[model samples]
Target: MSLATTKTSKIDRLAELTAKKETSSGASLWREAFRRLRGSKMAIIGAIVIAAFVVVAIVGPWLAPYAPTAQTWRGEVFANQGRFVGARGENLFGLDHLGRDMFSRMLVGARQTLLVGVVSMLIGLVLGALVGVVSGAAATLGGRAGQRLDDVVMRVTDIMLALPSLLLAVSVAAVLGQSLTTVMIAVGVVQIPIFARLLRGSMLAQGGKDYVLAARSLGIRKRRIVLTQIMPNSLSPVIVQATLSLATAIIEAAALSYLGLGNPDPAVPEWGVMLSQAQRFFDNAPMMSMYPAVAIIVTALGFTLLGEAMREALDPKLRG
Candidate 1:
């Protein structure tokens, strides 16, 4: 065979192999994400713990051995007969001052904690994404106007970032008054800057991609292109950000609760309020502190692990 023909055949084979390799790599990416996630021992453990807590929260009432509100007071001092309640065995978590079951309260508290985290992130995402998309798109109102808006938004974000988050939540919760809804709003409002910053950066980065430029060249509506094309492309980063934000939101809610700005009813078994109330009794009833503290730490750790896994999976640079 001619040398030129041989060379052409080699080039064709190389191109074919390259195409197959790329296809195989792309297919393996999803599988690799699951493998990496499962391989992270801490993340897997965290996921199990979080899942267990969620299940407890969901079925707590049914599993509770006694009504959470039932009080068993005895006539004699230090000899209370119907006083002890719930899962027996010397009261593993013990009873609160009001005689409510600690375990039950913790189970119920899960709903509150999860609610605040999810609701806050949702509100923050919507508001932040709107602000970011408009400001980051260079076509809208010329580059100077966009830059000015970005500057103003970023400065506001900086001011918010400067303030201590826990203190901010406490003050807001105090002003708003303690309630589940109020807690959600306080946490959500505080997180707006985070989402805005994330979205702005993502949008700006995505806007410069070839597909985005092609859309622009094709005279696609800026709004449609941004919403339909750019937004979808940026979701991987945003999803990871959201997962991490969930952990932050949970901690913030706990902080607010610790300051007595959480659930109005003291009977509710929330970890933060439990910690606040139990700190004084730490020397006497350490169980109170142990359970709730562990819950918060474990839950937060779970979300953090999930976030890390997601980041590694989606980011080609980080993936091995």
Candidate 2:
């Protein structure tokens, strides 16, 4: 056989192997990742932390001993004289500057905190993934026209990425006006560029592989190829990123709240709003700030750990 025939045979063989790997019951990446995750200490710890936080966010408020906003113990604490009450029999987390129950406020605020992170991450994921699918599919399948479309999309994302993430979110919040929805949108917008870029790059990488080349050579429809083959394989990094972005979303939401661009209602008990309130008495009563701050840090850490574990588990290099 000619050298060209030999090369073609090798490519065909490689494609057959890839197709078999993709179709095999035991070749599932998600299932393999789950098995790896189960064995990972980091994943276990992170899961525990996340589960505890979620349970608290869901149930802790219902069992709160005192009203989060009530100042029934106001007379006991004196902010003017810098005399704050420490944790005691009556109040577990001690009194804030306003003499409100810290424990109760934290419990009630957990829901809002979780809500902000989840909503923001979802907004980013949905919008960014849509953008990525268009850009990636075009660049890989649309030929010259596709490349141009991808270019236009990427250039816009690049501009957004060029700006500092926090600055962009702050600008968005500033434009939208202060509210919880505004915060979620602002934070979510900041994540769009990251996801778009990641997914587009991932799909492009997949486009060059033997399976894709074989599919193209076999006269498959571009849309079917993209939707069925390329899209599924390219989603690994994006999935991991979504997990990591949750942690970032929570922190960014809090930052917005700390900047006074959160829910306008002072009566609402949110972790970010709570932190903003605690900053005033940080010097006088550090515990007021400490509790919420620690909570935020721990929650972020838990997500980060889980994300890292997932990345490791999903790594193709470790499949052996």
The model with the greatest lDDT is 2
RMSD from true fold, candidate 2: 8.1
Best by TM-score: 2
Residues 140-177, model 1: lDDT tens digits: 32377767877887777666655666766777778889
How many collisions between residues are there in candidate 2? 0
Q: Clashes in each model (backbone N, CA, C under 3 Å)?
A: 1, 0
- Model 1 TM-score, all chains together: 0.82
For each candidate, what is the lDDT?
Answer: 0.67, 0.84
lDDT of 2: 0.84
Question: Each model's TM-score?
Answer: 0.82, 0.89
lDDT, candidate 2, 1-320, per-residue tens: 65434533442332222222232346687887788899999999988988988999999889799999998877767534656688999899988877799999999999999999999999998898889889999999899999999999988987787677789999999999999999999999988877777777778778888999999999999999999999888877787888889999999999999999999996788888989988887877888888988999999899999988988777665665
Q: List runs of model 2 lying over 4 Å from the truth.
A: 1-26, 78-82, 217-219
